[model samples]
Target: MEMSREKVAVVTGANKGLGYEIVKALCRKTTASYLTARNEEKGRRRSRTARTRPQAEIPSAGHPPKVYQTDQTLIVNFFSLVDFCETISPLMRNGGCIVNVSSSSGHLSRIPSQRLRERLKDENLSLDELKVLMQGYLLAVKHSRDVEDGWGESPYVVSKVGVNAYTFILHRRLAPRDIRVNCVHPGYIRTDMTKGEGNVLPEQGADVVVQVALSDSRGQYVWHNGTPVPWCGDDPRIWIDGKV
Candidate 1:
């Protein structure tokens, strides 16, 4: 494939499943597709195998932090996603797109606390503020009040919700650079992440990811199955406040 100056991409956890398919599609358009994961050997194998790979951290379960990796999930999923976007925005000028592969469970409505959701949308939400909010969840987990407190049983959903909220924040920050940002839930594909339990094929999930990656779409939590739905999984608060 011919490399292009205008388009280049990086995908974390792309070695298999939806992320791998994403790299495959992006390779057709981007000059270079950087595929990375925690397992370097596996990453290289996939990169050569696909012509790809994405991610860090263990999948979340509703358990307290008995070890280090579980707590690190919050850092990897939210902080890293934000930091990566901030760093890449300067380089991706003139209509570059960042697509954060997310999940439908990330929909803030899934989180029952109006107060917590509002904090996520805080106008001055800084990295520090975000950290505080997440740490609150950790405290809740420690005290065994996580479920009643509305973080739910899985930290995975909470982490993804953070991804969704920050996608909105980064869109506003990056708009001046003409770089659009968005997130997508790739429709529950059967992959290692899902332990091969999902209903969709990997390619089917990837087509949507490729679509958003190449488009001017921004601040959207959309999905691509047989039909595409834009502005999905939005918090009712956004609609209530008319803030997008």
Candidate 2:
């Protein structure tokens, strides 16, 4: 992509939280950003809301708004990401970049049962198969207040695992065309996802993602920052004796 020409980026779940911060960083450092949220009205409202607040009325005597708190937003979030990717596929210059903002929860070994783990290990899983797997997780979430209790207590964990799996899937399809497809664990950043518990900041996480998007064309999985954070042992090539 030309440095002078405007570049385009699509960030999912960007109304607030890390996603919003990523958009802010990208707008500051990169090119135009397509800020995506599950609810377009809500996203626009947030923009309006941010502007409407008086200087004196703001929290901490006028600092900034924070992450949105909601329990059942992921269903819409997944579909929003899909929509963004599909809509932008044709407009992408230099084959574009895709950053699936996953979590360390995706790498958890203690979440899934042995049978489910074995099932995920199979490389031949079809899109239909993956859908069924994901559906099972949604169902679990719907039926129980606690998703972990319902479906091994790893909905977020399993969703991210699926994300990592799909990253390689997209990479295989795009690498030949020189379209970069990669995944990153945002290092436990303090966002709604981490419930403000993580030590890392949103700006720090956004930097890592921006680095990968801007890196030279290399067909590899990476977590870009000061250095590449390797896949957490789930990758068979990197895994040795049951560790990454």
What are the C-alpha RMSDs, in order, of all predicted structures? 5.8, 7.4
For 1-244, candidate 1 gives per-residue lDDT tens digits of: 9656555688987777787887888786754789887789888988888842333234646545532433777778887887777787777756778888877667777677777877776757776677778888878877778889977777887888888878877787777877788888777787766766888778789888888777667777776442333333455335432333
RMSD of 2: 7.4
Error of 2 at 26 (Å): 1.7
List candidate 2 stretches off by more than 4 Å: 1-5, 39-80, 108-115, 137-151, 217-244
TM-score of each model, paired residue for residue: 0.80, 0.67
Clashing pairs in 2: 148-153
Tens digit of lDDT per residue, candidate 2, span 1-244?
Answer: 5465567777776677666777777777757777766678867765454332212111333322211111233343343444555576566665667777766555535344656665654567654576577666665566663345434654455666666656665666666667787776666676654557777887788787777777663434454233444443454323422334
Candidate 1, which segments miss by more than 4 Å at Cα?
1-4, 29-31, 51-70, 226-244
* TM-score for candidate 2: 0.67
Compared with the true structure, model 1 gives a TM-score of 0.80
- Candidate 1 lDDT (Cα, 0 to 1): 0.73
